[model samples]
Target: MIITKYRFLILSIMILFSVKGQSQDKFKGYFEPAIDLSYQVNPKYGLSFGVENRNVIYSDKNMQYTVKQIDLSHFSEYQWHSKYAFGLGVQYRIEHAFDVDEESELRFQEQIVYTPERSGFETDHRVRIEQRLYASVTKHRFRYQLGYTIPLAQKQANEPYLKFDTESLLEIAKTQKPELEQRLGVGLGWFVSSKTTLQFGVEYQLENYTQQLNHELFLLAELGIEL
Candidate 1:
């Protein structure tokens, strides 16, 4: 039964990716790599820190692989109930980090997450609001995401899992009109150890979909550790 469910999920994700790929004319590709560390403060509180970097791998205008940005983030979460949690996060981003003319950005975020108990699969619903501050402009964004995790093997060491998520974001700024973006992601993960996990994934993004559509794809790799 578990194997059948896993295959079905994979098939569905492939079909969706195929349809989206055919519908878009052009898209840019990026490679995103990140590492995250989490610490449990108590039963109801936790903290996490992460570093992520993005590189442009394929683009019509710029074909050469280029460093885009590096982000350092910290977040704190409070579990109010067994199935509900609230979080606050902050990020510092260095755009064109390897170049001389780099720019800096600061962002603050607030979020809530809900995870209901399930037998076979795990699900998450998240809502987040962010305030991004740059030198010239500030933007506010709202986002909601639905995510699923399916374990392929029985709960044990070195288990494998599949993850899928869809997110919608709305960005508002004073200088430009509001823009809507949609993201879809599919990933394969492994519990490398009791406190370590590794994941590889691909994500498709559509930016400014409400107006002029811009498509982007990201190849993702992440390592997560709990301490």
Candidate 2:
């Protein structure tokens, strides 16, 4: 059963890659660096903060990078291992372009995560609600992410693993004309220390607003630190 499921996931990802390869013009490269810090206050509660810097790479060969966006967020969470977790947070974001003043955004968010036990794969489901505070418009968004983590080596923190995930986003506040976005990603992770882990991956994102069918590809790096 595990082998079958693994094959299915691989096949699906391959299909997506094949389709993306056919539309080369629509594909753009994104480079992101993100870091997260968390401190456990107790067994069931914690405070976390993170920042991510994103850049658009117009020329991969030349490595021409442009400032795209930066996100900063802080949150508090209550969670138990192999169980459920809840969080509340706020985020401040800045968006930039080649020739425009930076736009700022604020967001209040709430989330819940649940992990279910399995023999070969570890799976988790996360649902998040957000209130977007923009300069002109206010929007409410909801996101659901399904994630799978595969253990490759030792069970200790300083080990290696593989992760795959898919997430979908929906605009719920302005129900009249809803917008949507979807993402698929695969990453490899290494626990550098007991309190630190690093992940690198490629993500394919599809946007709903464009008439021409195109996708954005992102090279992602994530670091987590525990205190």
Candidate 3:
């Protein structure tokens, strides 16, 4: 039990030291906007699609903005229980680069989610696995997210909520070394109507790379429509 309890902490401290030894720190900020749409065919099955665009700015001595990435994705979900669902998804992504070739990726994903009842506060958990295909490499990733939402108003349609979430990821590939990333976010979401929602948030990310660690802050907004 002691070993299990301290295993992650030990790993984190080691990684921190490793990252600190490499280079000086850098800070960056980003703005991301996304839209999603879903169709519910029945109580058990649904389909969703989404697009995302990301812009990053160097906030330090050099203040320049760049188009970072764009993504297009489609997914299908099956409800296994009243509060649980599974999904399969596919995505195409484009990443911009000035020095190297522009990178593109195809990703296939599977995910499961558990969400209990909704009242004053609701909590949810999600686990995901992905197979990522790049031009010269194939990678696999695992991610998990835990989130909570609290209703600002009574239990009614078209109400607003406050959301908080944290996520962690592990990536493995043959061409590149394994890496880990973590993110935390807070947001506000409103169900504008029976079939639509709007959300805006801020997120902080820490990513580990072969050479250095990356830290970023982002402002994000999303729109979801259900048909």
Candidate 4:
């Protein structure tokens, strides 16, 4: 059964890539790498810190293989119930820090996540609100994401898993009209040890879909560790 499920997942991913490849000329490619560390303070509370770096690998209008931004983030979560959790987070972003046109930003976030009891696959529903502060402007955004995790092997230290997620975002700023974006992602993850996980993924983003559509593709690598 697990093998069949894995085959289906692979076929679906291939189909998606094939369909999207038709418009590859219009898409920009980026690479993102990140690492996260989390500590469980108690049964109900947890804290996490993460850093992510993004670079443009292929783009028609922008310089290729250039540093785009780096983000430093921290979050705290409280599990209020078995199925629900609340979180607050802050992030500092350094935009084009390697170039002369460097800019900085601060963002604050509040979020809630719901995870029902596992039934074959685990699922998460998350809602988040963000306030972004730049040197000259402030913006507000709302986002919601649905994610699924499918175990490909029996529970063990070296288990493998598949993940799929979709997220919708709306941004509102005083200087510009509102914009809507959507993101779709698929990933494979491995439990390297009891406290370590590694993941590789691809995410496609449709930016400003309600207006002039911009297509972006991101290749992602992430490492997570629990303390």
Q: What is candidate 4's TM-score against the reference? A: 0.89
Instruction: Give per-residue CA lDDT, model 4, range 60-88, as digits (tens).
Output: 85658988899999999999999999999
Candidate 4, superposed: residue stretches over 4 Å from native: 1-26, 61-63, 99-102
Question: How would you order the candidates by TM-score, starting with the best?
Answer: 1, 4, 2, 3
lDDT of 3 by residue, 1-227 (tens): 43353356446545654664574776678999999999999989999999998887766646678788889999999998999999999999878453256668899999999998875578889999999998888999999998877677757777998877778999999876889988777788999998889999987777874456777778899999998
After superposition, candidate 1 runs with Cα above 4 Å error:
1-26, 61-63, 96-102
Q: Local error of candidate 2 at 91, Å?
A: 1.0
Total backbone collisions for each predicted model: 0, 0, 0, 0
Per-residue lDDT, model 2, residue 144, is: 99
Candidate with more favorable, higher TM-score: 2 or 4: 4
Steric clash count of candidate 1: 0
Task: Supply candidate 4's per-residue lDDT for 150.
Answer: 89
The model with the greatest lDDT is: 1
Off by over 4 Å in 2: 1-4, 59-63, 80-82, 96-102, 118-120, 155-157, 172-176, 209-212
After aligning candidate 3 to the native by TM-score, how far in Å is the CA of 23 from where it should be? Answer: 11
Candidate 4: give the clashing pairs.
none
* All-Cα superposition RMSD per candidate: 2.5, 3.0, 6.3, 2.7
> Weakest 10 consecutive residues, lDDT, candidate 1?
1-10
Candidate no. 1 TM-score:
0.90
